[model samples]
Target: MLIDHFPVLGLRVRTPRLELRYPAPDELAALADLAVEGIHDPDTMPFGNPWTELPPDQLARRVVQRHWKTLSELRPDSWALNLAVFLDGVPVGVQEVEADDFAIQRQVHSESWLGLRHQGQGIGTEMRAAMLHLAFAGLGADEAVSVGYVHNHASLAVSRKLGYAENGIGRGVSRGKLALEQRFRLSREAWQEHRSVEATIEGLEPCLSLLGAGEE
Candidate 1:
């Protein structure tokens, strides 16, 4: 019944090893707890924002708060869907896809993070592949883009493996210092060409209207 109203909650994206969905309360807690343990190396700031730099408690609170905040602000023209990432039914991280004026632009930008323990073993790349499928194939998006810190090889590697080519470079301030960023873009054709992970999406039809993607 709840899903009947918020069909986005019913949506699911599955890859070879990960399942991503609008997180239920308990799952969101698990995801938050995962963030408390850690995300990335403290020595280097990989994110453009210093979210992970907060104390563990503050960071965990931010994790849960951010998810709930997004839920309250959904709109057809501008919206973000932050899905909790799970491996073997255990929450491990988060993946977010967002767009402003999506109906007109037909483009989506994405970002994600994994618990420190889950950073390797190809999970990050596979989970991202799932979202790329959801965008280009499931939602008819024309292009997808992401910004990664130049030294964030892990994030950039995931983009590269998923067929994202460098769009350009920009400089930003992160952790009170200058940071170089690489903008990456992937077209539908490119996604199809380099997509290595197989992904399956479920229950997306009912949310198409909400996403303004029904016309596609």
Candidate 2:
């Protein structure tokens, strides 16, 4: 099985309403379809790269290619785990956690988006909480950080609900205009206190070193 050669592919995180895992090729295709369906308002670009603005064909290709690129380039020192978010066996979106020099800094950053039909339904918070569990409880991370444009209330609210503190503020360009960004940080201590959603990790032990979780 592929998991024998790349154990990270076996990793899974589950919450009451969601399951997050590395997407198989077909699942990745489903995700591409979901992305084409729509992730956000056409007028607003939540991601710094403005990937959502691409045409349907390009967007689908980008989704598949980006996942392939990340998997090909993963290493202990730097990696991004873009877990496909599944709800009731259907692909809904993505919840990603990534780090640079995680063995030393022990910190991870996360970002996510949901299908337009899935937004405002609280699945975002639950899925993010699952990733937090995988990072802190499963991977021994010291802190987790996230950033959102100041106007992105859904993202900001999820961080606040999870007990993240305002870490800093900055300015960046969004869709060609200057935008304010809000950074939030959640330490392990805070995570322990604020954790509410029940979550579990499976197949993480074998993938630890691949994620730089065993370097130190």
Instruction: Identify the candidate with maximal lDDT.
Output: 2
Q: Residue 25 of model 1: what lDDT?
A: 86
**Pairs that clash in candidate 2:** none
Q: TM-scores of all models? A: 0.97, 0.97
**Model 1 lDDT at residue 67:** 94
> Model 1 segments beyond 4 Å from truth?
none
For candidate 2, the lDDT comes to 0.92
Regions of candidate 2 where Cα sits further than 4 Å from its true position? none
How much does candidate 2 score in TM-score?
Answer: 0.97
lDDT of 2 by residue, 8-118 (tens): 898999999999998888999999989999998877778889998889999999999988888888899999998999999998999989999999999999988899998
